[model samples]
Target: MARLQLRNLEKDYGGFKAVHGINLDVADGEFMVLVGPSGCAKSTTLRMIAGLERVTGGEIRIGDSLVNDKAPGERGIAMVFQNYALYPHMKVRKNLSFGLRLKRRPAEEIEQATRDVSNILEIGDYLERLPKQLSGGQAQRVAVGRALIKKPQVFLFDEPLSNLDAKLRASMRVRITDLHKQLKADGLQSTVVYVTHDQTEAMTMGDRICVMKEGRIMQVADPVTLYNRPANAFVAGFIGSPEMNLIDADLSGSTLSIGSQSLALGPAMLERLNPKAASALTFGVRPQHFSLVGAGEDNALEGRVSHVEFMGHEVYLYVNVEGQQMIVVVSATAYDRSKIQGDIVRLQPSQETAHLFDRKTGENVSLADLH
Candidate 1:
């Protein structure tokens, strides 16, 4: 329900900067996700937004208010931690109603709010149960319910599903997204800021994903845009499931030479390239974009199959192109398992799906002008 803005937000610990100067504006009622690997400053940023960690510099604003100097409770924000953070001695009902009780709300109002949150989260049956008696999923629901009862202007989640099993994580993801939609449908301000290391969660849950690395923002875009038109090689390699294969190649005029093979570039690619400069570039192709081709096919990279992995409907082939290893995905039904390791195969990358990045800076050269 609130627009969140972090202007030049920074966090430093004893001269060591954990978060650099990063700027972002989250629209009102938007679901934003911060995704990256470990030690990427995602949790630190979330904590700063929640007023749990003091900012080293810059400002943290919620709606029209400057909340940099406000305490966590006064900032009108509720947070759900990764570990559930439930009080072991308190029952589910007490845990959910604790915040309201501290504010000294009326008894009937607290009861009604607790009931509403319990019904929304489907944890009404465990109202009398303690945290120790509940399953991991149930405990997580209580933790979220605790935050929901507050009805804060902004919600912050710090890897809230990391402790659950794979199936539970998927189920919880759907539940959380549905909850967000329901809140929006009911005309409530339910802006959310979620932090997760899993790209799957970021892709499915976020309206816009902010990809971070080494305490800096890399790229922020919708899931499809980030996948199809990555801003840089780091974003391209980090967002995809079977990460994009980046191969070193030489660029000359309208042709790209990968290893000993040369592939002609299309007009669109030629327009994106620097015609006067023939330099070393990184050619990126996704696994699914590579197709099987005959030995005599043009624009094909010939390589020996180094390994084969069957993944239900699709198979991933690990091919060795000279000294470099590349992965190609093919339908399991169409692939011949008999041709295993050491088998020679030719893969032709789709020209339209190929990505070109500057070798020196790791920036996507193809998208330089567009972005």
Candidate 2:
């Protein structure tokens, strides 16, 4: 568990920069996850930490040592790749002990390390089997066991569960979380940085998640902060399931209108608006925040439901209102299916929960004055 610091880090091939100058810190024993869409340079960042990719510029520090010039072996880091990267020819125990054997470690120590890792991973019974005979999850455990045998300072995982089936991936996620905790309890100085494009893994696994787009970080926050208070429109739209509903509207001196229809927020919410914002703005609301409110001036908007989807425990309904679309999630037991699609209804959002952003800048302006 080592503290890592990356300052003004960059990766370039000739004139093209794959990764811009990025700064980040990984606390000792912290589980940090880097997540982004394809071509966002998250995998590049993780590989740079593993010494698999050269740092075009900036310093890479593990604990107090600047390791920019160190080779992968010299940096004392073990990387678990997406493919599991196991040796098909070797038995599980042999694969697990390969690194130690390559380093010419003593027989007794190697045996003890292999035994301990297998026990920790609960793969002790499969040690004699070859990789070909093992299940996907078992093979992955062997891959992790290989890394553990080296007992390196840092662990880098790049979409390690991407190859597994849905059920296996879910199970492996829990195992990996438990494995991190188990490692920390042993007082090892290991820093972990996992890279994934999957939102569920990033949300469940990371102590801090760095959301990236176009090789730049949009926001780096814990899951709770991200879900409740997004930093920008992209982050808000990208981070949530089904995303937040964004609607264009008119903003006057003291009133907000969705075209001819007017809606209102609490005084506290209104006070946060830009004093000069009399032109227009965008209002955002999460699906779960919307509810039916009686029609009235400056209260709600009328909408005709277009579709409703039943997702077992809840309902997702799409409503078209005021030339815009809104998604609402309702309790399964409360919302009747028969009146879902054709009903003409008025919908309102809680005053405090509504998020308002500047139309041009897309910055959060709803609660700016209150803060």
Candidate 3:
């Protein structure tokens, strides 16, 4: 196992900066995930650590050793790519033992290693089969098994499961996580760095998730913390399945004006805001935070139902508030569309779940002191 550290790491292509100065520390034996949309520089960051891309500035270290000057093979790291990259003519056994063969390891040693990995991955039955003869999931296992044979200190995965179907992808996510646990049980210290565009993958498999946007790191935290207490509006909108609803509002002392409606700020929330510093703000509320309420209830907003999605046990309501669109989620058992009056509904946001952000900076004003 190895501890990885990036000190003001940067990458530039002529005049274009692909990665900005960023710093991160990954503990030994940790499973860290880098996730973001395309063009966000997550893959570039992973390549830099693997020695596939040169750093424009700052240092890259692995286990107290500077690796910026080292070749990929000399850095004690193994990588699995999105395409699997297995040889077409090579059988499963040959693909897994290819690296060791190149190093001229003994015949018996190679046989033993191949047997162990194949058994662990449950692919022993197909060792003699070529890559073309295997299914997508089986081929992926061979690719991962090839990397495992190297026994490197760090494992890097670059969207290794993106090629599979939804069901295969879900199963592979669990398989990879279990593989990590198996490695630990076998007393092999293994550190992993995974990159993906899927937020679900990051939330489910990572020990900690790093969210990036453009060329900069946005936020890094455990899944629950990232969801509940986002550092900024971008994170609040990015981490959840149904994105958080952000509405423009004007703040004056303890009163918040959303369109033509007003909500009195609770004392705890009022203490967190500086009225003189911010007049215009963005009020954020997640879909699950809004609940159905009586039309005359305090802090309730009246809206017409634009659309409704019946999702088995839960229902999502798309509401048009004035000119803005907002989404609300409710239990299907508690809400029935046919009983509504004039297709109009009253939704109220729980005061304790409200999030306030600075309109100009996009920073979460409520969490100013926490960061």
Candidate 4:
């Protein structure tokens, strides 16, 4: 049982702290993703777990072992890098078996392991090809095969799919998730810690995702929980495609004054608000949560269409609400093409899914009652 745990894990680069004291746990056979924008200390945290970066404070436990002082190879972890770090001079087979060869395993054992991994990754045909002869996707497969060949207690991936194109990245995402399931079914220790800045990757690939900001962890949860019930304004904005619309407003007696328009927050929505909520708030609603309604509708925000994007199945309507820009996604078939720029529209936000954040703290004041 190789359950990974970090207790107050920290990394201090000289005087500047890169990773604050953060605690996390990755259950055995679980795929955990660390995701955030650049400079969020996610990669630093992954390196520390792989023993490449020194932990300034706290403990890192892999099952029964405390491996903060161990070398990278001694941590029973295999890492796949973004660059597909296969040995340039060696063929795919040789690259896959290098670690086993270094440990002086018998030739038969190394060859069998390489063959097994190559088949699993579907790189058997490229066994004799050098790294330079392979395409980006093929090279990435060799990198994953190399890690799989190790059968380590934990697997670490550092933006492994970022180098590939959009289409390839999508395919590889499915491949990696399928591989994790395959390993788990085979009773292998498949604990995975994957790091990426892409929220889409985190959402689709991880069993649970850990979101970090600066040197602090923002939130850790499954994709559904993070999307439908974000803990704060940051997670609500960061995890979505076009991002959640966060606009400043004044909440007075179950009514929200957004710019020049006033919205009556119905009693059901009012009951869901935190009792300690303040008057000043950052109203949060996703673009998809907004419905295009008739003009002069009650409890709706008035806006004028500024721009529109005609996606195949849906239309992205960009509107200027007062001075702030807001986006509403409507089905292409339902959108009237006659309503072009400068057209007035009303957007009704779904009260069940709307969020209210404290203006000063950026904390979701309506979150407690949501649960």
Q: TM-score for every candidate vs. truth?
A: 0.96, 0.92, 0.96, 0.97
Ranking by TM-score: 4, 1, 3, 2
Worst 10 residues of 4 by lDDT: 333-342
Q: Report the C-alpha lDDT of model 3 over 1-371, residue by residue, as the tens digit.
A: 48999999999999999999999988888899999999999999999999999999999999989999999999989999999999998999999999999999999999999999999999999999999999999999999999999998899999999999999999999999999988977878679999999999999999999999987989999899999888888889888889899988888878888888888888767766654447788999999988888756787888889999999999999999867899999998978655457889988887677789888988888764664
32-95: candidate 4 lDDT, tens digit per residue: 9999999999999999999999999999999899999999999999999999889999998899
Return the lDDT, model 1, position 206: 98
Per-residue lDDT of 189 in model 3: 61
Candidate no. 4 TM-score: 0.97
lDDT of 1 by residue, 1-371 (tens): 49999999999999899999999999988999999999999999999999889999999999999999999999999999999999999999999999999999999999999999999999999999999999999999999999999999999999999999999999999999999999999988799999999999999999999999999999999999999998888999999889999999988877788878888888767766544333788899999999887756787888998888989999999998867899999998878644433498888898777889888878888864665
Superposed model 4: Cα runs more than 4 Å off? 337-342, 369-371
Task: Please report the candidate that would top TM-score against the real structure.
Answer: 4
lDDT for each candidate structure: 0.91, 0.84, 0.90, 0.91
Residue 301 alpha-carbon offset, candidate 2, angstroms: 2.6
How far is 371's C-alpha from truth in model 4 (Å)?
Answer: 8.8
Q: Candidate 3, which segments miss by more than 4 Å at Cα?
A: 271-277
